[model samples]
Target chain A: MSFDTELAEAQSAIGDGFDRLFAATPDLPLHRAMRHAVSGGKRLRGFLVVAGARLHGAEDALNPALAIEAIHAYSLVHDDLPAMDDDDVRRGQPTLHRAFDEATAILAGDALQTLGFELCLAPGCHPDAAVRADLAFSLARASGADGMVLGQALDIAAESAADPLDLDGITRLQAGKTGALIGWAAEAGPRLAGADIAPMRAYAQALGLAFQITDDLLDHEGDAGEMGKAVGKDAGAGKATFVSLLGADGARARASQLVDEACDALAPYGKEAASLIAAARFAISRRS
Target chain B: MSFDTELAEAQSAIGDGFDRLFAATPDLPLHRAMRHAVSGGKRLRGFLVVAGARLHGAEDALNPALAIEAIHAYSLVHDDLPAMDDDDVRRGQPTLHRAFDEATAILAGDALQTLGFELCLAPGCHPDAAVRADLAFSLARASGADGMVLGQALDIAAESAADPLDLDGITRLQAGKTGALIGWAAEAGPRLAGADIAPMRAYAQALGLAFQITDDLLDHEGDAGEMGKAVGKDAGAGKATFVSLLGADGARARASQLVDEACDALAPYGKEAASLIAAARFAISRRS
Candidate 1:
């Protein structure tokens, strides 16, 4: 099957899984808010888990795939809080805090986070308990102060810093913010299979950077109508990004180079890893 | 040793452990806020873990013990948010959000939550991978919507309800809000040792109720200066509580009875569980 077909299939499967998970719970407003926050997404992170696990011959990747998606959704919800990015809209709809109340939104995000860990630790995610523990451990690092949260802290600190972040500073910031989770997703197959993760790890590091640069490129040049949420948000906030530090053309070139590097790191997997390679290519080419 | 001696020792050890953990992290404001939030607790939950694990002959309880403590601290920090309880004081000091900005407080709580899971998943927590996974999995339920978060949501919902909660409603609310984590802590030893959890589970259930009743009694009768925060806040808000529904004397009687049941449930351990027996007794007797 083509990469697009596989990606679309994975997205559908993950979404269905989440729908089932949510349906099992009581229909409290908090549950409703969680459903609202996690409703729709491209499911790229989920795709990474599913596709990567497939490469390693793991049959039950759906739980971990949905787990990563849940974490991604929770992070987005919290990031969009009034005191954070203060985003009014997400995925072309009102943000959770705006749709519900601030307290409900906060609780929804918190519950979603716990749900992520629960899914990862569930027996369905992987047969090996050690693998489950490893996933939880790696996820905590990716999402905690060492990774995504730390990146957010740095980003917030940068907004008021006397000196604008240079290319290196921005690169470090984006690595923690954007790269860590992606890195974990790409390595999921190896983690579940108890296989060597070096190749996938290297691939993910490059792919993550490419993904962030493409985001910068989209913000710099993509039309707002095509991008769903407002474009130029990073620039508007006066925050330094890949585009700001490296220029639009330079950023695009860099993203292309990283994509190549990402694909090359998967040489050991050869033809079996075609979907992952396509994903790296799609990271830079998509408008949204 | 008496429960008092054991509890004091556990508190000191847990505090030192947290201090070391925080000291190793970068000196960011978020890290500082996390440190502040985790400081000066009585470490009752930590004691539960250590004492329970020792009963089951599990040598390495510190990691899981601290993990639960981290989760508790994170919950408290978020609970004190302006959007939630809006309290400015905790443990006789300014709350995390008050000492720092709201965004920092939110991030600190988020990071601390991740840290809790991280600690549980670490090899040091348990030699067996299955044990680590179990800890993480059980924690998600206790701390998430099914447990603590659900309790808080119900409490919030109750505040705005046209009708105040009856005894049953208040009991269910407190079960979720306060009972979950305490239950998790009390059962940690069996979880680590892969022993039968029925007895410990029963003990925890009764002890948790006793603990909450004591809290209500303290608020109703103790001085604010002694409690380290405002007293009579629950009654002031007109929220239904065990004390409100059972009446002051009735509540005290119920607490004592529950404490007796808690100790009775630990008969399986007999003389080996003296400290736990003391812990049950201490639950209703604590002034703060």
Candidate 2:
């Protein structure tokens, strides 16, 4: 099947899985707000988990796939709060805080993070308790202080710092903020199989960095109608981004280089890893 | 050892554990804020884990002990946010958002939550991967949508609710809010030992409910100067609490009866359970 078909399938599966999970709980505004936060997304992280599972011949990737998506969604919800990025729109709809209220949004986001860990640690994720523990441990590391949260804090600090983040600083920040979870997602299949993650690890690092650069490029120049959220905010805040530091052409060239790095890292698997390679190529080429 | 001495030791151990854990990482406002939030609590939930561990002859309860306290602290940090309870003081110190900023407080609370799950899943927590998974999984459930967060949402809803909650309504809400984690903490040792949780579960239920009633009583009549935070806020909001629904004398009577129930549940352990029984008694008699 084509990568697009695979991606679309994973998206639907993840959405269905989340629907089932939330529907099992009592109906409260907290649950409703949680549903709203995870309702719309590209599900690219979920796709990474799905694609990796297929590549490694690992069955029952559904739980981990849903887990990563929930983590991604929770990060977005918290990041968009008025106290954070203060975003009013997400996926072309009002942000969670705007759609419901700040307290609801905060609790929803909190519950979503726990929900991700819960799903990862679910017995269905892997029959071997060790594998389940590994997944949950890695997830907590990637999403918590040493990874995503650290990156977010650094990014926020940079916004008000006397000096803007230099290229190295932003790269480090983005590695934590975006690259960590992406790396974890891609390597999850090998983790489940108890196989070496070196190749996928290298592949994901390049792919994740490329993904962020492309995101910066889009935010720098993408149309608001197409992007479904605000654009030019980085520049507006005078925050240094790939586009700001490297210029549009420089950023584009770097992204292309990183995409090449990503695909080449997967050469050990040759064409067997076609979907993942396609994902890397697709990351830089998409407009929004 | 006396319950007071045992409680003091657990508090020191948890504080030391937190210090070591946070010290290994880079010092940032987020970590500082997390430390602040967990710093001054009475650590009643943690004491339950310790006392239960002693009763079941299980060592290495430190991780699970710290995990519950972290969860408790994170909830308080979020609850005291401007968008939530909007409290400015905690433990005689400024709340996290007040000491730092709102954004840091949110991220700190978020990271502390992940930190809790991470500790529970740590290899040192148990030799059995299944046990660690169980601990982490149960922690998530007790603290997430199904439990603590649900309670918080209900409490928030009740403030603006059309009518004050009846006794049944408040009981259900308090069960989710305050009762769940306390129950989980008391059951941690049996869970670690792979023993039946029925006895501890019964003790925890009564202890948790009695604990909340005393909290309501304290809020109704205690001095802010002594409590180190706002008192009378429950009545100030006109929200129904155990004290509001059961009157002062009635509430005190109920708390005493529940303490007896808590002690009675531990008859299976005989005098081996004295500290836990003392803890149940402590729940009502103490002020702060």
For each candidate in turn, give its C-alpha RMSD to the true structure in angstroms.
1.2, 1.0
DockQ of each: 0.85, 0.82
Model 2 chain A: lowest-lDDT 10 consecutive positions: A51-60
Best by TM-score: 2
Q: How do the predictions measure up, each by TM-score?
A: 0.98, 0.99
Determine the C-alpha RMSD for candidate 2 after optimal superposition of all C-alphas: 1.0
> Cα lDDT for residue B214, model 2?
95
**Candidate 2, which CAPRI tier?**
high
- Cα lDDT tens digits, model 2, B1-288, are 899999999999999998888888887788788888889789999989988987898977999999999999999899999999899998999999999999999999999999999998989888998999999998888888998999988887887779999999999899989999999999999999898899999999999999999999999989997898989988988899898899999999999999999999999999999899989989999988
Worst lDDT 10-window in candidate 1 chain B:
B222-231
Q: RMSD in angstroms, candidate 1?
A: 1.2
TM-score of chain B of each: 0.98, 0.99
Candidate 2, position B93, lDDT: 92
Q: Give the per-residue lDDT of model 2 (tens digit) for A42-137.
A: 888889988988888887799999899888888999999999999998888999999999999999999999999999888888999899999999
